[model samples]
Target: MKPKVIRALGVVSALLFLGVLIAFAQPKGETVKVKGEVVDLWCFLEGGDRGADHKQCAISCAKAGNPIGLVTEKDEVYVMMGLKDHQPGKEVLLEKMAETVTVEGTLVKKGGVQVIYVSSVK
Candidate 1:
């Protein structure tokens, strides 16, 4: 094989390897159907705020652009996100703030933080 051809092949192989590594490195999420309470993350995590009494405040925080999250029956918490980029996950959960609701989405965990890209809420 010509030297130039061999060098081109080497570069292509390197690029292919890099692509594969990047793909693997990305956190591919899993689909989930979770029944939990949608809470304002800032108030919930900071002060353990939740329930009917906190509903109004939760809504206020959501309106103020605080992050929303879900806390499951088993005490698992997942930061909620939108299914697409440049969108806030709180859109769907705002009305359900401080209330228990079922949510369906893709859940991804990285660096000890769990995030769910919400697809549906009920």
Candidate 2:
């Protein structure tokens, strides 16, 4: 095999490995104090109203493992999850649905969708 071809193959291999590393890298989210109402993202996205009135249904959806988000006063919804073990925590959010609460966590953005990884919820 030609020396140039061998060098080119090595370069390609390195690039592929770099790509894999980037793919596996944990995304970084800015730490923020987010004050909002826990909401069922499925309902919020579908033009459903969320407030004291929708509390029961929102809690039900959250309890059922549906997508949950924090709907800020500005009307922005951020998908919420527990930072511990990097998994969703619907139980912590179930009763808080449609109620105002403060969440401190890292805000991460992927594929144009914003998500907040909660370190603590209150």
Candidate 3:
């Protein structure tokens, strides 16, 4: 039809295509359920400090933007992070430090480090 209309349609189509490509290019993770005690990764890994005595410290560290993690009953630790939508998983972890809870999330592992993009906790 009109030249301007044709150009606008072409630009719109290109934008839609680019959006789909970016969505597909994002990394995907396996859904998993992990049971563990939430801990501040800094003190937990650096000095084995965790559990009841370390609960307040863990919460403070999380509020200060330090990374949090889960220590499984089996002794496996998975770094806690927000979901792909950028949901702040640390907030959830902050409430449960030194307390065992079940976490549902997308599990991603790379370079020998494991992380959980948390979705739910109970």
Query: Which digits, one per residue and each the tens of the lDDT, describe model 3 over residues 23-75?
Result: 97454899999999999999999999999998999888888888999999889
* Residue pairs that clash (backbone atoms under 3 angstroms), model 1: none
Off by over 4 Å in 2: 1-27
List per-prediction Cα lDDT, in the order shown. Answer: 0.87, 0.83, 0.87
For all predicted structures, in order, the TM-scores are 0.75, 0.73, 0.81
Candidate 2 residues 1-122, lDDT tens each?
Answer: 69999999999999999998876654576899999988898888887669999888888887777889998889888998877555775846776888899999889888989888887888
**Minimal lDDT window, size 10, model 1:** 83-92
TM-score quality measure for candidate 3: 0.81
lDDT of 1 by residue, 23-95 (tens): 7754478999999999999999999999999999999999999999999989899999877654686777787
RMSD of 1: 5.3
Q: After superposition, how far is residue 15 of candidate 3 from its true place, in Å?
A: 6.0
Cα TM-score of candidate 1: 0.75
Maximum-TM-score candidate: 3
Q: Higher TM-score: candidate 2 or 3? A: 3
Ranking by TM-score: 3, 1, 2
